[model samples]
Target: MGERIKLPNDPHSPEFWVAVRQAQGIVGPVATDTISALIDAYEAAWPGLPRKLADSTKEKYRQSLRVVREAWGNLQAESLRPSHVQALIETLGATKPGTANNVLDALRAMCRWACGPREFLSRDPTQGVTHFEQGEGHKPWTPEQLAFASDNLTGMLRRAYVLGRYTGQRISDLVRLGWTDIDDGGFNLRQKKTGARPWCPIFSELEVEMSTWEKRPGPFLLQETGKPFTTNGLWKKLDKVREDHPQLAGAVWHGLRANAVIRLRQDGYTSMQISDAVGMSIPMVERYSRYADRKAGGQAILLSMKERKQDKTVKR
Candidate 1:
């Protein structure tokens, strides 16, 4: 054996013993809590008590987290590698590319937070993994589709669709609204994902439509008895509507909110104006206004063509 090298510290001290043990690589395993365990706790603590997230956004992340937890919950944080994450993307992406990308984003975000100051993770396992390519976000409801729902749907469905189209609020929040939620001025409510309280102004047209339903019993528009509609309940109603009308294919509730943004874009509203009207972040408003931006680009091209033709005629 080589000569003893520990001459600096007191051999009898616990500190010295810890150092000696560490020197021999005899440290215990990193925190034994599994990824699943951490995820379980995270879900429980979600939306932050005081800070709060919008209910719909919570559901979206909840679904993604549930999927990731099902796949990697038992695996140790350090055990997860880029290849493992890639495999998850491939497996999940087969059925729904968009949802697979959502899951990937959720995992990456959660793992990044875990590795932050919390030290729940030694490092982010999702490193170097790219999210699956996704198509453009939710398809906005057309004005014609809105008109159809307004005309066709008799009781609750008609109200839900029209309100969604005009207010541009999330279904989760919108369905819970009652007479008290709206007054002569406008509709007022807190966002489900973000906790911001947005007061959407009610136009005369929207007001006229809402007046027809305000006399009903509960504050909730789409209700069973007197209670607000659950997220799934609202979806089922929309699904039934789709079954009846095929023209409404591929449209979802979130898209209903986008309809207002799209309309604002067509009216040539800036990103800031749309954000103000829709109670969304400026960035989100910009994203929703992409179609409007595209239209504006075309208009610019037309203007340039006209200017060139006019210049040529004047020179001649």
Candidate 2:
């Protein structure tokens, strides 16, 4: 009988109160106030996300929301059917399984927030969604590949490449590194991805490398304007490095991070020690450590008391 309720231009906008008032007259059965309240709850829950999440992670959430809107733009929260969610996930899986699973996770959280404890929708749609399985493949750098890449990379690209391989910091944190972060001992900074602050003890070789460079005003890895290198710019440099050294084609920038992890574990660092050194989660360190152990045929050296007794007996 009255004016029809319209969704706000920004669904997250605070102007939903006006829309809610209008919706009550048109839709008498289901109150718009309830929907607005659910939306508010969802928005409130969004801000308390852990600092460990990187900027890229927030971007992924935005992308997931776009995916959701594209698939089911017309569907109301209360009217959303399980089949709709399944179809949306299927669409996402066709192009990107990993992204799709991430989207499903975000959407599931949103749906839970909207529907409360009960199944307000037809059913729980994202229950059976699965993430893509990454293959177990490590193309470790051969001597020739390493030589080619090192020889071709000149200037800052070379330095960044070498440092990444040696230190194993992710490109995100490595590029933003400044002289202030470095010292006579090592470097210390909060890892951008995990927000974990770590202190790395620099080796003599790295020390020598640092001494060669003058103290710059900005990040160690900088653009022509002396600004810190963005992730995209770093990737572009990586692409150039790969092109220059064709043998290292399959070597991703992140592979250096993996290389560092492997080397640290090989050097007899414990999982916890490596995690602290690399500014990674303990679980991630454990995963890499397990992989390293597998690669080295589980060749761990243990100083057992039984071995000590045997040695003493042999001496006697």
Model 1 earns a TM-score of 0.72
Question: Which segments of candidate 2 are over 4 A away from where they belong?
Answer: 1-53, 71-95, 108-130, 137-143, 289-291, 298-316
Q: Tens digit of lDDT per residue, candidate 2, span 128-160?
A: 655555345344455576678667777778778
**Each candidate: how many clashes?**
5, 0
State the local distance difference test value for candidate 2. 0.68
Relative to the true structure, candidate 1 has a C-alpha RMSD (angstroms) of 10.7
Root-mean-square deviation of every model: 10.7, 7.2
Superposed Cα deviation of residue 63, candidate 2 (Å): 1.1
Off by over 4 Å in 1: 1-31, 47-50, 53-63, 66-74, 79-87, 150-154, 182-184, 213-227
What C-alpha lDDT, on a 0 to 100 scale, does residue 15 get in candidate 2? 56
How many angstroms is residue 28 displaced in model 2 relative to the true structure, after the best TM-score fit?
14
